[model samples]
Target: MVTIAIIGRPNVGKSTLFNRLVGKRLALVDDRPGVTRDRRSGEASLMDLEFEIIDTAGLEITGAETLEGRMRAQTEIAIAAADCVLFMVDVKVGLTPQDLDFAELCRRTAAKVILVANKAEARGAESGVLDAYSLGLGEPIGISAEHGMGMAELRDALVEALGEEAFADPLAEDEPEWWEEEAPELVAEGDEGEEAEAPPYDDTKPLRIAIVGRPNAGKSTLINRFLGEDRMLTGPEAGITRDSISVEWDWRGRKIRMFDTAGLRRKARIQEKLEKLSVADALRAIKYAEIVVIVFDVTIPFERQDMSIVDLIVREGRAPVIAFNKWDLIEDRQPVLAELREKTERLLPQARGVKAVTVSGETGEGIDRLMKAIVETHEVWNRRISTAKLNQWLSRTIGHHPPPAVAGRRVNIKYMTQVKSRPPTFMISTSRPEALGTSYTRYLINGLRESFGLFGVPIRLGLRKTDNPFAPKRKRPS
Candidate 1:
């Protein structure tokens, strides 16, 4: 796919437009300037035109040793590698000295450039659109990434600028690296017709896993262990990490994006604005994560704060696996590990039978088991059940313990079918759906989990009344 870099000053809606094109909230968006520190890239498709888009940190002039300077260096790398550059300007704020400076940098790069005037839907932005001509990058395209206007025109402009590069080979650009990992045999009905068969499930998008826990829980240490190097700054200090940094890696041929987030301190203790931003960033990481590894130091395994973080992960419906860090420090490994398992099962029974792998973040023990558990839990989360099998299981379950009656009328459960997965939501058609109690809902949820080997994943059960389509026009009578 062609690479397009969204280069602009801070808070110009670059991340927002990135999400708009990628069709997911892959990048975090906030009103505060410099919220995005690292460069974020994702595969984006816009109205049949597919490309890889990189959202870079906002440009600024600072000392080379400073944090802002490091951010500028990453953005420059993105600009250099991209086949096309989107020079975004905030139409509402108009152009500034920084905008001119970045425009000059883009011009020097000599890459195909497209000037995008974001937030152009607002009033009085016409002048800002007119002023963009002074930037010396051809004609500026007036568009609103927030309101999603002028996309057709934007597509046309991209095609105009990139010309042949605008159209990429779908197979080469979009086809995932699944065959590189596993080669499934092809099936044919005739004599010798042979072609490669693609995997039924999509293993393309990197599985996004966020490592989160209380302060000083060895979250960063565990990430460094995974990387086999000191990738993230680690110390004895609490809250060493202030921003959510993500790294992409291929583990056992399965691509994964691991997010090392700031320690989530208690709300009452968060006094500084920077800490508040860190917590928000951490929460955003959890929201988009497929699996959340709740890293815990074995020395102090289950604090109230740790319990709250695990509860939050479960409540968010992300598959969670507890990685007990610093396991090498423990003396009585068997009993202590057993108690840790007991505490997890007792405290977070909502995620019944949660996986807890003992690992030494410093020594890298049981890291393989932890990775396996993560992949297993993700598969359970993505499980889909056939309608026939689901109904069969539900019927067998209800027969053993029938639904309790309400107001002396028995609730009739007609049928059950899975509506979706990735948190495996199912719908149960019943006569008196509203009459069912949360207790009964819990029963069905537990049964669904147990029967389908859904052990630790969250199951959402919904009750929908089966309507009679052709029976009785008398429903609306008089």
Candidate 2:
């Protein structure tokens, strides 16, 4: 599909237009300028026209060394890659000198350009729309990106620029693909096995992974290394990333969709509404992701906030792999890594045996190992043990370390069976479930992790009282 990119000076309602086109609030939008520093892409449709739309950082006129300048560079790159550019102008703000400057730059691009006069709903915006003609980019199409006005006209403009053929409908294809036709059959067959605990994972589906950490943990840098492209904006800046940007990539022929999220600071420190929104976006990414990679600054590894994030990931039931970033900065590697691993087990006992990879997102070190660990952790997260094996393990484990009696009554765990996989939930029928102590439950969880290789993932264990059918009927009397 043809890719169209939206470019304009800061706070020209670029993100609003992007969200309107994409039909989702994928990009971060605020009253402030430069809320968007990195370019975000999504599939968009205008009427019958289905195409890819890119939302880029506002173009700024600043020196190359500054943050605004870096944002400008990203916008330029977006313009270069796009098949068409939507050069947006704030008719409400009436086209600033910066808008004129960027218009010249857009005019020089090889891509097709369409001038968009935004905030056309406001009174006296027509003069600004008329003034946009002096930029020499042709008639400015009036649009209200915020109120959803002039979309039909905008669609007409896109059709005229790219032609109806460029907006090919994906549903036009007659034949159903192999995955659509046969993948469900494969899943059903695997699930029908006598000893099958969980259906085989569909490799054709992309793995959704979210990278999260405290501010300046190099989450974006690590993702850029994985993609082998500067897809994320990175710098010495602590909170450079604002939106949880999801990028599609392939590693070793495995499809991966990675979310680069904003740095999560403590709640007390987050004063601005924008930061709150960023944090919420990051959290949503974590909730939806199958695997979460918690990137840590090696120098400040296992900080309080880092542990909190890990606990959150655990509570979210996401498979986690700890990534110690900036390993190149560490002088003594072996002893440090060993100590870190020990600390990990102690501090994060809730997620015991979780995988930790030493990586340098800057110099591209240990990335291969990181990717391998991610895939392995995902498998472990989706692992299931058959009823026979689970019972056998439980019997052996109980024999070695039986549960202590509560109130002189023995609490007997009769049977256990895995109910589901993704994060591995199990149900146990017990004689006195309420009498089971937390320590004994922990012991059982640890045993399950050790016995079935269910490491690096959250395990859900539930207890239900075993009903005695022979002698447990109570008479209902008045």
Candidate 3:
């Protein structure tokens, strides 16, 4: 993959352009200088071409022992490793001596450099962009990263610099449509029939997964472990991240986009505007995600707030997997794991037996198991049942236990078929849809879970009242 490093002095719109290429606000962008201390890498797309883009800290002169110095060290590493470098300059502020210094540094690194003159939206920007030639970094690609001007030219330069290897998705081809099948019909029991099936999951498409939990539950730390880098800022601070940052990576040959969301706190406790925004952003991520990992600090275990978060995800109809972070901190692993498992089963009955993998986000323990659990749970969430199998099971279940008599009359269940997956929705045609008690629905859901191997994911049962259409027609004919 072609690696492009965005390198420049502070406040040069490097992070802004970084967010643009990645197609989302994954990096924390502020007007304040030095807001980005660590270098961040993401899968970036310039039109059809895709490659890795690294957002590094602004270059500064400081002792190697200083924080800014260490940050520059990180940027240096990125520059050396990069196949090409995007040397950014704030055209609005004009080129400074520091820009020339960084330009010389890039020249010494033996990497192809594309000079980007940012903030070139105004008429005056032309003069500043023209002045960029003094640095001798070749023609500047004038752009306004904030306003998104000149991307077509930027795309051209990137394709030229990175050559044919920097291939973009063709503009001519349309996005592949997700396949849909006709709803299966309720045929006679034991009759062979094709089940209504969801389109096969396009695994090539990145699986959108969100990591969420209470304040400082190691949500960011766990994601950092998965990425094998300190991509997210982590410390003793509870709510350092205010935006839901999505990082795209390939795991075990399958593409996955991981979202590191802000820690969610109780609504009453959210008094600050920033905290409220953070919570809102996190909620948005949950809705967008196909799977959510509800992380827990193993030492603290399950809290009432944590259960509420899980409830929210279930209500949103997203697949959930429970996980414990900081497992290395726990003593007597076997007993602790057993107790956690028991508690998980008892507390979050919404997703019974949801794979509760324990991992040390800081130490990188049990990460593989956590990943496996996520993949398996996602598969189960998308599972569909054949119409014949569904009816056969429903008939047996009704025969054995049966819905309880409602007002001295048995509520008839006429038919059942799967309407959807990705939380596996089913529609049941019944004589008295309202008479089907929550208890009986739960019973059916539990039976479906056990019989069909859908153990942990939420199963949605929609009741549809179907009256005989031909009955009215028969009466009119008479």
**lDDT for residue 198 in candidate 1, whole number 0-100:** 19
Worst 10 residues of 1 by lDDT: 184-193
Ranking by TM-score: 2, 3, 1
| Model 2: pairs clashing at backbone N, Cα or C within 3 Å | none
Sort the predicted structures by lDDT, highest score first: 2, 3, 1
Alpha-carbon runs more than 4 Å astray in model 3:
18-74, 94-101, 122-141, 150-208, 227-237, 240-257, 268-285, 404-409, 470-478
Global lDDT of each candidate: 0.83, 0.88, 0.84
Stronger candidate by TM-score (1 vs 3): 3
lDDT accuracy of residue 102 in candidate 1: 91
- Per-residue alpha-carbon lDDT of candidate 3 for residues 127-238, written as tens digits (9 for 90 to 100): 9999999999999999988889999999899878878755644453454522212243333433325544445645454577999999889998898899998667676766
- Higher lDDT: candidate 1 or 2? 2
- Which pairs of residues collide in model 1? none
Clashes of 1: 0
Model 3 compared with the native: what TM-score? 0.78
Clashes of each: 0, 0, 4
Poorest lDDT segment (10 consecutive residues) of candidate 3: 177-186
lDDT tens per residue, model 1, 1-478 = 7899998999999889988998977676778888776677777988979888988888998886776776788788889899899999998999999999999999998488999998899999999999999999989998888878989888998899888555768457445542122232222223122322212455554588999998888998898888886556566767767667777788877788889898987899999777887898899889878899998888987888888888888888889899988888899888997898889889888789788899888888898999989988888887777666777788898899999999899999987766666777777889888898999999999988788898887888888887877777565757
Task: Write model 2 residue lDDT over 1-478, tens digit each, in one string.
Answer: 8999999988999999999998999898999988999999988988878889999998888998898888888888999999999999999889788988888898787479999999999999889999999988988999999999999999999999999988876556767622221221122212322555556655555688999999999999999999998889999988999999988888867778889999999899999999999999999999878899999999999889999999999998899999999999999889998999889989998888899999999999999999889888988887777777888998999999999898888888888877767689888889998889888999999888888888879999999888898886898997
